[model samples]
Target: MSQLCNVLIVEADSKNVETTVPLLRKMNSKVSYVKQGLNVVTHLQKKGFDLVLLADKLPDEDGFRVLRRIREKAELKNIPVLMMLSEDESKKAAFESGASDYIVKPYMPYELVARVTPYISLVLDRQKFTDECQRKDKIAKQLDEAFTEMEIMSRLDPLTRVYNRRAFLEKITDEQIRSRRSQKKFTLLLANIIKCRHYNERHGYECGDFIIKKTAELIHGSLRERDLTARWSGDKFMILLPETESDGLEIIQTKINKVFQESSFEFKGMNHRIDLSFSSKVCTGNDDLDLVLKEIE
Candidate 1:
């Protein structure tokens, strides 16, 4: 690799270290030597090495510990691990622990080279596969996050955090379509917050803003989660209550009136009880949502 032919070689025996170091060095490879498996994890994270050469048995810990740690890490898991196994059982355990390849102890110089070459190739292939999968997963996650953000943005008023006009309309359209498909009843409640205009005239613009925000909160808290509510304009609010009948609409309207009737606005000691007058219509056709809204208005 153009970046760095990095390898972490953990060998407790000095003779194997001496024999392997020179030949590995001659290949223009950078090597990290350690006799303990305990230090393997720290070195792998700190150094960002590409290959890990771990002896199956170390002074303090066995080779499987390092392999397990590497597999656990999302970043380091894909790095090639060339394990030194002494027996068939050791080899099986290393393979089970997700080692790419393993060579037995008392390994020859040429045998090490042969095994090392194929192991590196295997690591490169696995790394490529991993990178591709990550790239796709990241893209999918980004798309999902983006869609969620857009959906949230559409549903909420930018300043007031209430449902925006667009979101309100979209929900109305959805309810209309469903009502048409199922012939289920629905209602559209159009509200005129009359106090907003009075506040705008008597007080400064800030007072009007405060009034709108308070009105939004009062109504939002009064509604069910399934209810679609939005601010249509400075003084107008819209609610699309799906699967609702005339009785349900009247009941909801009564609840809304009670909620606003009990609440008081005391911002900056400017005490006022805002009145939000609402009018609604039971939907008969789905395709004529705009027409129904117009009739409600």
Candidate 2:
């Protein structure tokens, strides 16, 4: 690796320490030595190391226990552990305890360099890939949320918080197609406000806006959950009642008319009762949406 390698040595033998530190330093590694297996866990926790060169024998405990402890921790688990064995017999035990590799001593300096370099480079590459994947996933989630909000905004009237004219066109077109396929009928009801222009001229545009919002709330409250409501244009609202017959259209119109008559609007210390003129027609599953809207208008 191009970076400086940090190595923790868990050997107390003075001859091993004298021989190993100089060999690793020649390759520009930062080496820390500890004599006991007990100190290994604490040093690993407080510092970041690239690899551990653990002796088969320690002053307090065996190297196998230390290796198991390192593997058990999530943060330290991926770091490569190379056990230093005095005999050829302990190779199997080293591999079983999750040691990445091992060395037989007394060993050559060049062999130590060869064994340790690949593990350090492999770890750095794996970490880079994992970080990149996480970053891309986060950006994907943010983009999905932004698109959802934009879709909702496009369908709604900004002032009244109800479906806009574009939404009405889309809904009517879809309903017309469904009616033709299933031979099911639906009703379209239009509620036109009386004297809206005169009311806006007398009170102010803000009061006119208040009336539109209140009209939407009243219409929404009187309709079934399955029904769709939209603002067709200035001072006009439309409702699409799916699977409803011609006889049911009058029942809906009467209910909305009654509610609008009963409701009152207050502006600048004046109280005013509103009026609505209702018109409704049942689709025969054959009419174009433009022709339907034109006939009602």
Best TM-score among the predictions, by candidate number: 2
Clashes counted in candidate 1 amount to: 0
**Candidate 1 ranges beyond 4 A from true positions:** 1-136, 180-184, 201-203, 286-290
Q: Which segments of candidate 2 are over 4 A away from where they belong?
A: 1-55, 65-79, 84-98, 101-125, 266-272
Q: Candidate 1: lDDT over CA atoms?
A: 0.81
Backbone atom clashes (below 3 Å) for every candidate? 0, 0
* Residue 191 lDDT (model 2): 86
Candidate 1, residues 211-238, lDDT tens digits: the string is 8888888778878889877888877888
Model 2 lDDT per residue over 124-165, tens place = 566567777877888898998989988998999987778999
Give the least accurate 10-residue stretch of model 2, judged by summed lDDT: 119-128
TM-score of every prediction relative to native: 0.59, 0.68
